[model samples]
Target: MSEAFCLELYKDKVVVSYYAEKFHGRKTANGERFNMYDMTCAHKTLPFNTIIRVTNYANGKSVDVRVNDRGPFVAGREVDLSKGAAVKLDMIKTGTAKVKIHIVKMGANTKQSAVSAAKAQKIPITPSKGTAAKSQSAKKLVLKSGQLYDIQLGSFSDENNAREYAKKISRAKFKNVALQKSGGNTRVSVIKVDGKDVPSVVKQLEAKGFGNAFVKERKK
Candidate 1:
């Protein structure tokens, strides 16, 4: 899915507004044929054929349309709509309306346009408000104890070798060895530990060519 985007509002004049099918086959400002009946839309700089969702604030109704043509081209206007599109949102009579526009992803071109535009604008991509809370809760479990520790596991094919190595390590030994069998290989991992032991464990592991590892805290 394309990232959510904000509709940039122009100086209060229904800047990027819609036009309908009566202008079908008519020449758009950018020299493309305008087709009103198509579920398409227009924008000032958005590439043609880009699909956008137009939502009427007053009625809370929205219509998705493709950018088959170029724009309202009027000063301060950000988009232009076809007559049919305006009627669907019930904004035709006013000749202009306040609406929120968003891009809908149904294909690659629309996706690229939405992405390129979003990058150019430097918008922050954030999870939904509801999901954001869950993320914060998850992060809270990772405590900082102001100490360092070593965390590790063994993956040698021979069980004896794995045990001997574990015993040789000077740090306190954690016994849980999770042997995971994938295809013909068996891998071992140490999944739990005290927050204080993380740094020392990582340092030892790095000296042995086993790089730093992430810590996962147990949930109560």
Candidate 2:
């Protein structure tokens, strides 16, 4: 049997649909001047200046967006991503895409400054290459005991591809291979059981030629 699974979990995952249009040069609820080109988002409840990982289930794109505004009260829409974030998630043409937003950390200030000012304050607003792709692999991942973990290999535009990849993971000794669909994309993942660690699953994924595989909180 594998060891106790570990991962940082704040139990936060919000299904969101980004902005319907542009909102540049507006003052955010946090008193920060909004820049549509920045990697920021507007959340209704999360404290301002909180950093989050927004994964677009449509195209499998993920980006770190800071929460500096409040909105998306258009019923069913959770938060609104900036123009830059929408671009990163390939949501420009779609306008809104189904997304999973994970709370990463809080910002330095209760109400974070604008992206430009935040950068000037020496805060790291932009993520590195690895940090931006495949679920922020550049950032440190902490593993904790007793929580469930999943090795997500890929999100494809086709459900067949996702099923095929799940088959591969199953052949590699991983169990509970599953396919999840949302926002026009299908994802392949291996649900962990028997106390497996996230890194071990990641290694298995790498051995199976999925070096870009990333860990996500297993849905209960």
Candidate 3:
């Protein structure tokens, strides 16, 4: 499999939904009879039988599920869980939830399955040579500098206030939001960004009512 394909599988900010009675007993993409009561899930490109831990971001409830089918089929949604798995995460009432996915083990069909699924979805199989070269150059530049940028959302003297604000930011669907504590201050910030992207990220936060957001640079 191409490096680009492998990297895409690990990208974050996954939103998931569940399917239950409607799909139960149907033949899945992997040729198995769907069982809504079983701990199985459908992913766009994960290989059949791959195991993953799905954690609900809001409540911290998590469940281990095996990939047995393909897709949530909707744009902006990543994985589709079985009713059983969704129940385990206490997300049945919401129908859809923001979650974190951690790969537990890769399945045997990793290469073949991912490639075929990507093709079906009309996604590029590999990056163009120029794109790949540019990406490598960018990585080298970051490594050499050992510097990173953050968009600070807020800083509070109280830890509880900082955590509550962080949760509020997360519920707004912002990516990479986190809380950091140092001394008596707790800061809520978005921790993933290139220096050049700081302005745009700050603009996004401002639009969502975080008008005090500012950029901070840190050396690794």
Candidate 4:
């Protein structure tokens, strides 16, 4: 159930990136006015309002960020920190960091770490080809391959608009992210998973206020 999923905190080693300051004042997927100076983050699947600890490996710096937006539209990146987070991690120059993330708490519940650290699975975060390494702490969690129900996040008359939306959807943090260019529309790419996961995925998106999220059959 959604409530149960929210109660469990997820831990993962993911390639972390930052949101552009240009979107600082724009509306987030949760209908929030984004402020890049705040210590916030954008995650794909983590429940909105969740707080996480992000540790930057390059500088050995870490910071706590609240999940307020979604994305890192490109693959291999799991979390997108606001400028303030990037500054805390000293990642403003390289623009990316290999880091560890711990879900510190769920909304109104500060006890997630007490349970999550003991029970949360550490999913692998794929780094750039230059930085890829083996993870021995936990095995990866993946949906079984089958007839996956693909969801079209958006279709835009302008290419930039589509790409922008795709980036936001990427914050959902699923590895099988995709994009297709046809004439003008760009949508969040599809993933191949058993049809059963569709409802759950949609529900998570809905919980975050993405009411238009839906699933459709993939084209062969």
Ranking by lDDT: 3, 4, 2, 1
Runs in model 2 lying further than 4 Å from the true structure: 1-15, 20-22, 108-220
- Give the alpha carbon lDDT tens digit for every residue of 1-220 in model 2: 3111121222234456565345577566666777888889875445567877777777777788888775553434667888888889888887777766555566674443333222221112223332221243234434445667665555655455456556766777767788878677676767663223555555555555444355565556
Which lDDT values do the candidates have, in the order given?
0.49, 0.58, 0.65, 0.60
lDDT per residue (tens digit) for residues 28-105 in model 4? 755578899999988654556887888776777878899776564565667889998899999999999988776567
The TM-score-based order of candidates, best leading, equals 4, 3, 2, 1
lDDT of 2: 0.58
Better of 3 and 4 by lDDT: 3
Single out the weakest 10-residue window by summed lDDT for candidate 4: 129-138
lDDT measured at residue 105 in model 3 versus the true structure, 0 to 100: 65
Q: Cα RMSD (Å) between model 2 and the true structure?
A: 16.5
Candidate 3: lDDT over CA atoms?
Answer: 0.65
Taking all chains together, each candidate's TM-score versus the true structure is: 0.43, 0.43, 0.49, 0.53
Which runs of model 4 end up more than 4 angstroms from their true locations?
A: 1-9, 108-220
| Pairs clashing within candidate 3 | none
lDDT of 3 by residue, 61-180 (tens): 878899887655454677889999999989888999888666666688554443233333221112222211111112212211234666665555546656766787788788898888
**lDDT comparison, 1 vs 3, better candidate:** 3
Instruction: List candidate 3 stretches off by more than 4 Å.
Output: 1-11, 111-220
Instruction: Give Cα distance to truth, residue 66, candidate 3, Å.
Output: 0.6
Q: Decide which is better by TM-score, 2 or 3.
A: 3
